[model samples]
Target chain A: AQSVTQLDSQVPVFEEAPVELRCNYSSSVSVYLFWYVQYPNQGLQLLLKYLSGSTLVKGINGFEAEFNKSQTSFHLRKPSVHISDTAEYFCAVSDRNSGYALNFGKGTSLLVTP
Target chain B: DTAVSQTPKYLVTQMGNDKSIKCEQNLGHDTMYWYKQDSKKFLKIMFSYNNKELIINETVPNRFSPKSPDKAHLNLHINSLELGDSAVYFCASVDRTNNSPLHFGNGTRLTVT
Candidate 1:
């Protein structure tokens, strides 16, 4: 079975500061990586996805993530964050051969303060 | 219009009662799924349907049943709901062929008291 691990449970940063949420996955075969964000009282939304070809994937809200196959990591990063960027971010992985059911990690809470 | 929509955005009911949450997707995706978000903010897949056929059924309790009338709609019915069943349930859909991104509904917050 595949699983995702998010090292940071909570990350606090000031507005306009850069942020990075670390994510690592364990899988036996090729995998697809994704990042989803959930705002307060709302459902999860796709931030970005890495299917193939590109190692660096850019997402909405000026966020981006790089897929490192050797390290088994897909860490989400943003050069600068706004207060509106504060939310819970989840890292997920799906085996290429398996169905579309995603394996999500325990979300990382991003708190951006002014 | 909402890409994915679930009825009764907030449902509060007593324990032992039965309730159903209806979900519909306008994106015309062939795959739909039900995910449960617990208090700890862990999202787990409960059920998945492809073209109105059950594809993946996780180790969820039998009390939680999912029915897909067609490729565009999937509904979840819970029997004898318990306190542990109180959480946010999300309905999502995806285009199976392209490995498209999953589109999620706003979610239905079910509270059992």
Candidate 2:
């Protein structure tokens, strides 16, 4: 079974400040990692994914994540955040063991203040 | 055009009632899924359909049933809804052939009163 852990429940930052959201996973098999952003009253949108090859994955909206195999972690980071960036972020994992199932983390709420 | 769309973005009904949420995908994906987000913002997969075939159940309560009449439509029907059933139901679709990212609908917020 694959389980995802989002270290922080909520993160507060001023506009233009760098932000990082930590995520960790536990799985015995190789898995696909993904980051999704959910705006208020909107559905979750894919930010980026780490399938294979590169450890550093860049996504839309100037967000990027580094996948570390040794640490079993995929942390999302942005050089700077905007007030529009405030949203709920989720880390998800999908492995061969769990067919068609994306195990999602509890989610980290990002509050970008001006 | 919306890649994934679900009807009745907001639903409020009394307990013990029966309701259904409709979903459709224009992405021409063969696989679709239903995910539930609880009040705490935790997401869990409830059902997945591939090529109109039921692929995963995920230990979801039998009260929830998924029906796919075609490749692009998957509808969820809940029987005997309870207060605990109040949550956001998101429908997503993906092309399993190349492992594409899942496209999600706006979601239906169901509130059981």
Candidate 3:
């Protein structure tokens, strides 16, 4: 079984400020990583994914994540964020062991202020 | 058009009542799943179906059953609902053929009183 741990449960930042949401995972074998965002009263949307390619993966809304195999981390980062970026972000992992079903982390709430 | 859609966006029922949530996907994907989101925003996979066949069934109780008449539709029926069952249920689909990302529906908020 695989597990995801989001170091920070809540992140508060101001508009135009850079932010990084930390995520770490533990798995016996190589795995695929993903970040999904959920706005208020909405479904989860894929932000980015790392699938055996370049360590740095770019996603929508100018968001990006880097897969560090040694550290077992795939943290999401944005150079500058907007107010609309406030949402709950989740880090998920998947592999053949779990039949490719994504195992999601608890989630981190990102609150962007004016 | 919505890729994945579920009906009864908001369901409020009393305990011991039975309710059903219907889900459909037009993406022609071969796999569909049911996920539960708790108040704290944690998500847990409940069930998954592929090509109208039940593929994955988590440790969920038998009181909760998932029926897939076809590959494009999956419905969840909860019998004898409890207060603990109050949460948002999301229906998602994915193209298992190619390692595509999962597409999710808006979700159905189930409120048990």
Better of 1 and 3 by DockQ: 1
Give a tens-digit lDDT track for model 3, residues B45-99: 9999989888889999899999999999999999999999999999999887788
lDDT of 3 by residue, A51-91 (tens): 88799999999999999999999999999999999999999
Question: Evaluated on chain B only, what is the TM-score of candidate 3?
Answer: 0.99
What is the C-alpha lDDT profile of model 2 across B1-113, one tens digit per residue?
99999999999999999999999999999999999999998999999999999998888778999999998999999999999999999999988878787889999999999
Worst 10 residues of 3 chain A by lDDT: A94-103
Total colliding residue pairs, candidate 2:
0
> Residue by residue across B9-100, what tens digits does model 1's lDDT show?
99999999999999999998999999999999999999999999998999999999999989999999999999999999999999978889
Q: Stretches of candidate 1 above 4 Å error?
A: none
lDDT of 2: 0.95
C-alpha RMSD of each candidate structure in angstroms: 0.8, 0.9, 0.8
**Candidate 3 displacement at residue A11 in angstroms:** 0.3
Give the lDDT of residue B103 in candidate 2. Answer: 89
Candidate 2 per-residue lDDT over residues A1-114, each given as its tens digit: 789999999999999999999999999999899999999988999999999999999999999999999999999999999999999999999977777468899999999999
Each candidate's TM vs. the true structure?
Answer: 0.98, 0.98, 0.98
